[model samples]
Target: MTAAVPTVSDAEAAVILARCDELARHSSLTDGIERTYLSAEHAAVNYRVAGWMTAAGLTTWQDAAGNQCARLSGSTRGLPALMLGSHLDTVRAAGRYDGILGVLVAIAVAGRIAASGRPLPFALEIAAFGDEEGTRFGTTLLGSRAVAGTWLESWWDLRDAGGVSLREAFLAFGLDPAKVGDAARAPQELLGYLEAHIEQGPVLEEEGRALGVVTGIAGARRFLLTVTGSAGHSGTPWPRRRDALAGAAEGITTIERIARAEGLTATVGHLRVFPDAVNVIPGKVEFSLDLRAPDDADRDRGWTLIESALTDICGTRGLDLASTQVHEAAAVACSPRLRAAIATGIRSTEPTTAPADAARPDEGGSDSGPEAPADDAPRELPSIAGHDAMAIAAITDVGMLFVRCAGGISHHPDESVTAADVALAVDALEAAVRALAADYPAL
Candidate 1:
């Protein structure tokens, strides 16, 4: 027998997209002289979102640590609940959709469910996590980490670029820094979590697909490299001179070559040279390197190649070199059950559209493309960037749905998405949520 198909109405999808666009203009997660953690502007956006949640028929409240939550109780008492959420913070000069879309979409979905007058089997909680951007405090996912009980005490003392401590910022926002532990929830209390967000990349648009069933979050390592060599007069003969800038340039080129050859993604995003004079031979250079892969072993192998190349280049060029690790996070695989549920929902809701491509064919299943058998689903891709879902994954079963982004441009003022794509994503999410609610009823 064929599985029952679940679907959402076009009207419902439109309502959700309208709400998302409305919220996007307000938080403008992309705007602020600087909304970095603890800034007055950041706090304002948080409070505004909380108010919007309350208006949407949720019992919204702000935690002692400033995290915001909006609760929607189901008919089943004492049943494990599902959390749907995403962050509200943005990177410096970020776009509106990066983190805000997921949270607002959750809110709209919950509102739709409530308006239907059908009592859900399990309760749903919508959260708008704070400070995931790490633009300030130099720490990411502060709100979600707290909820998962993974936040460290040392986090309170962490400072921003301006040397303002997290604790100071918390107090300034009228939140108690010492009460952070209150954010943790019993793992048993949360049955699962789901997030719907923009792809923030070119994949979906390139493939002409409306949805991306996330397979896993990629592993990443961030480090800084410094190349030092003697400064010399600009007119000095090339034969007898040591150029730190030249060595750093060679290192950059080597990194590009290695990453391209290995099929790994490597980036040298930031670079600084010493000395203020225009003609001065640079004595020192510092650059940040970020490398990511689908798994730890692959990520490590890429880094090893990078290190070997750097050492060889520095040694042969008579330049001193050093490296420091800034941050590292391992890849996370989504639950198999959740992945299947999302794909099933997508197929059921939009029969005319193709099924999701299996991200890792060997592990998930075969990707037969559009011509594949009806039983086969397209492959889902792994996301290299960090996401709010990562934090939730640490505590409970988590799944993600990606909406197509226009030109893969994110974290910029010009970031945008089409109205039709937004509607399609909402339909997929609604169907997915209803299916999960039925299959994984509160116990």
Candidate 2:
């Protein structure tokens, strides 16, 4: 016989949705950075979230560095706790569901557990991380890294576009930079973590799936390229003068071609021309390139090609070239045990369908062979973008479940998801949390 479908009340789902809307309405984008970590807005939304946590029976508190926490004590108090949460902030012009879903769902899960009056095997702690987007400071995973004891003090000296240091930003938000170390927690105390999020990609929608089981976080390398050449009159013949803009254009095309040839992804998202005048040939051009891949070897190979192409293009164009690494993050793998739990939970919710396939498999091994039976359930895919869970996964076991977003659009006013998708994800999450907390042996 099929197992019963895990259900979440409409009221609970509505509450979670409402919280998402309310948080989005606030202008929490950090000043100057303006993409994430708005001080005033973070304060406003976090306060409301803290109040909600208390009402839901959690003992809520804010850490020295401003991470908000809500604790629900389990019968096994001395045991390591289960963490369920996501960041409260957003990228500049971010959508409501990106990070907010994880936080609100944790609240909903904790609330449901309390109302059910069932004793849990381990403690549950819901977290609303301070700033995962790094929209203000150009550094992502600010909160989770601190908790993981991997945060660097030099990060405090890094400045945003506005010239304000992270230390100063923390002070502006009433957090002490000197006390950042206080945020660290013993690794043993964190049993496991789970984050619910929007897929932020087209994989799920293209496959007609409701949810995705994430396997690993993609590695990213970002750089700023500056191409310098002599400026000249726009009226001058193209062959007579060295033009930086022309060289930059060639570099951009080369990057695209190399990334495609290597089967990696690269983007020239931002560009600027010196003087930016219509009449000038342009003395200098600056652009930003972001490259990403699933593993280090692939990423390194792609970057090697990128540099070679840039060097050759600059030499042929007689333009000076300079590049600097702006950001780099190594890929992180999810725990096998937690991944199995998520798959089991999803399959349990819709037993008629086969379990979603793992996005990544062991080396030299296939998760499913060519003749493997097809499942009625949709397949899960890996995420190219970064999220708070990536940071948490560095120090503790963490897993992620992604609900389908409409049209795969996110980080904009037009981003959205359906209520039905939300309901399904929440149901799966509730089951997963219960099963993980129940001490079921690893699959």
Candidate 3:
């Protein structure tokens, strides 16, 4: 359960943070971060990351799916690889560390391992996926799914907001659409996958801990719900009017109540009203529902309850309700073996102290600074947000370690993490690799 180094210094953590800021400079936006899939910005960052990987004694290449990949041989020159990575693409106006943090931390870990002059049971690989946020083309994990050999031919037809097809975008990025298959990795060519990511929720921050172990990624269902009712004049009698907006408001509230009662998450993040004007009653309403749970059965049961409630709300309001399911994904459990390895990593770790400017969560969520952590025991939690691991799960067993982020804020510019946590994260992941190596033959 020991690593080449017991603790990654705060100085190294500062370097990771500095690298993040440097990558942020390649964003498309003039004002904020916005690196989408296959954009010039993506290529620029990949080039920058490749330089870092090479300096760390790894062979670097860009896969057909446009993932930035690097490999370092173990004691055995041609053994299966243990891949460690997270996405590099992001939603528009994203924070500095959502996906970027994982990539940099992984580089630090790999760099340290190579510097140790010791080889593990398997080779090491890093993949900086180009598209996980799906901010540009409306498809999540395209990068990782391609690597998992799950790329759909129809994906070429998918277009972005500017009406550029994925196929065209690939060519624009100097990639051949026909060669994307080359990115796929065979199941036998790897041991397993591990991702170190921000909690992106307040659990760790609230509990005053620096790191946590992910139990599983939540199963999710997304839908577009429409309410139809007739528009009316502002002067229409209340008894005669059918207010779609009002009905939608009631429906959203009911969704919240049912989700709360069921211990699930149901969010109506987007809403649209037709015939919108101060002088007219709304004729129709369209809203989005995002439901998630750690268990597929529990998620389905919660959705059933939600459907019943929405039906009742619509019926009472004399409105017709219709729903179209847009997306669904089953729960992905982290491998028990890998989970144990991560736990071993956490238990053997210690925190590092850095200057305030090095890293600190100061905005809204709990900022636990470089203080002593709650306990050495692993804090286990489920990820509600989707990740690249969700797609990579198709090819291999996966595990994740969650680093506490500022107030659980992500996908925004204010996302924060302290250097103390980053240092601990690097230590834990490095130790996890060693732990896995020790048991590689049995695994």
Q: What Cα-based lDDT does every candidate model obtain?
A: 0.75, 0.77, 0.89
Residues 298-378 of candidate 1: C-alpha lDDT, one tens digit per residue: 889999999999999989888899999987877888877777767866665344443234222113542223432445464
What CA RMSD would candidate 2 show? 7.0
Query: What range of 10 consecutive residues in model 1 has the weakest lDDT sum?
Result: 359-368
User: Per lDDT, what order, best first?
Assistant: 3, 2, 1
- In order of listing, the candidates' clash counts read 9, 1, 1
Query: lDDT by residue for model 2 over 1-443, one digit each (tens)?
Result: 67544444445666777777777767734321122563778888889999999988999988866788888888766666788988887777667777888888888878878777896777888888988888778778888888778898779798877898888888988888888888887877888888888888888777656677889888889999999998888898867778999899999998999889988879898999997889888999999998988796899899998898898988988889999998898887777777777776676545322122322111242222122123545355677888778778766888888877767888776666655556667777888888887663232
Q: What TM-score quantifies how close candidate 2 is to the native fold?
A: 0.89
- Identify the superior model by TM-score, candidate 1 or candidate 3: 3
* Clashing pairs for predicted structure model 2, backbone only: 35-92
**Winner on TM-score (2 vs 3):** 3
TM-scores, one per candidate: 0.88, 0.89, 0.92
lDDT of 3 by residue, 120-180 (tens): 8789999999999988898789999999999999899999999999999999999999999
**Residue 47, model 3, lDDT:** 95
Better of 1 and 3 by lDDT: 3
